[model samples]
Target: MVKDEYTLVLVKPDGVKTRHIGEIITRIERKGYKIEALKMIQPTEELLRQHYADKVDKPFFPELLEYMTEGPIVGIVVSGTNVIKAIHNMAGATNPVEAEWGTIRGDYGREWPDGNLRNIVHTSDEPSSATKEIKIWFPEFEFTQG
Candidate 1:
């Protein structure tokens, strides 16, 4: 039997600036996933640092941080069987150039002249990351036992 799985999806700053939030949500709903929770937040440096701890020390982290903080982002908790992997696939490749034409990033993302890749969304790569990330964006949320 298929079990309900949850994942975190962040429509990053670029996506918000470009006003694609509605379209993104429509796509997610079209996939038959339930949006359990959603909120728009202007992320703090502390919050981003916690969420991107693994990438904090990377060379381009500052650029990434700046891009993320440029505007408010929409955080969504989506639930469905295999939603984590499915959403990741829907988000497309990290680089829009490498993403498939129909995926979110491929359709709405682009590499800026500054060399930053403005991917439209961020989805948890796995269940553990989803749990960790969901807390970062939705601290008040009650987690499932699964």
Candidate 2:
């Protein structure tokens, strides 16, 4: 799994508003990864609809969509060895309350309006997901070596 790899990294609205963009990017780069593509965009309802479409029928879907569209987010494509799994480990659990101390979620998140945990980041959960998400968020951008 050491071959060239890429994963999507998002600096959620909270992260961006809190100025954690630089810190998050530093963490990834310090781990020997390269950022391939990046953008700051306010996602549309349709965009969020497609991105989390799988969770559309879930109980938390509405709130999640609203939260995502609340403000601008930094969407990025990062490349390196085992980047998908690496990013997931760095992001930690979905529930910040249960996330490990050193992970991004644990350090920056708190419970949200609906009593659900409001982690400040999102990482693709698998290789297939990474591919799908990167395409969804950065369709025009292509991965290249740094």
Candidate 3:
């Protein structure tokens, strides 16, 4: 049997504000991932800081925080075989302009007027990130590894 893996998927503020949550969720489900838990939240700057600790000092950090906290985001625990990679692929490149067609970013994300990173979804890029993010996004939810 294929052991199931889990990923933390978040449809960012822009996605919700633009009403792309349904389409994004539909794509995840269509790809065979299971959403074990989900919630909408207006994330804190502190949480964003911790989440992007490595990039917190970068110039774009403030913009990232402001953008992320702009509105409510839908966070989901997505599970399946190789879900981390699958979700990232679906999210496309960090810059929507470089993303391929059919990807979530390519399909709906648009470049900011100033060329900022306005890609819609934020999916964990690795197992480590997934583990950390799952905790931050769903602290009370319990998860079991297969």
Q: Which has the greatest lDDT?
A: 1
Candidate 3, residue 21: lDDT: 92
lDDT, candidate 2, 31-93, per-residue tens:
999888889988888888778979999998878887887789999889888888998999988
lDDT of each: 0.94, 0.85, 0.89
In order of TM-score, best first, we have 1, 3, 2
Error of 1 at 82 (Å): 0.5
Q: Which pairs of residues clash in candidate 1, taking residues 3 or more apart in a chain or in different chains?
A: none
Number of the candidate with higher TM-score, 1 or 2: 1
Model 3 root mean square deviation, Cα atoms = 1.1
Task: Please give, for residues 1-146, the per-residue lDDT of candidate 1 as tens digits.
Answer: 87888899999999999999999999999999999999999988999999999999999999989988999999999999999999999999999989999999999999889987689899999989999999889989887745
Error of 1 at 114 (Å): 1.0
Pairs of residues clashing in candidate 3:
none
| TM agreement with the true structure for every prediction | 0.97, 0.92, 0.95
Q: For each candidate, how many residue pairs have backbone atoms clashing (under 3 Å)?
A: 0, 0, 0
- Cα misplacement distance, residue 115 of candidate 2 (Å): 2.7
Among the numbered candidates, top TM-score falls to 1
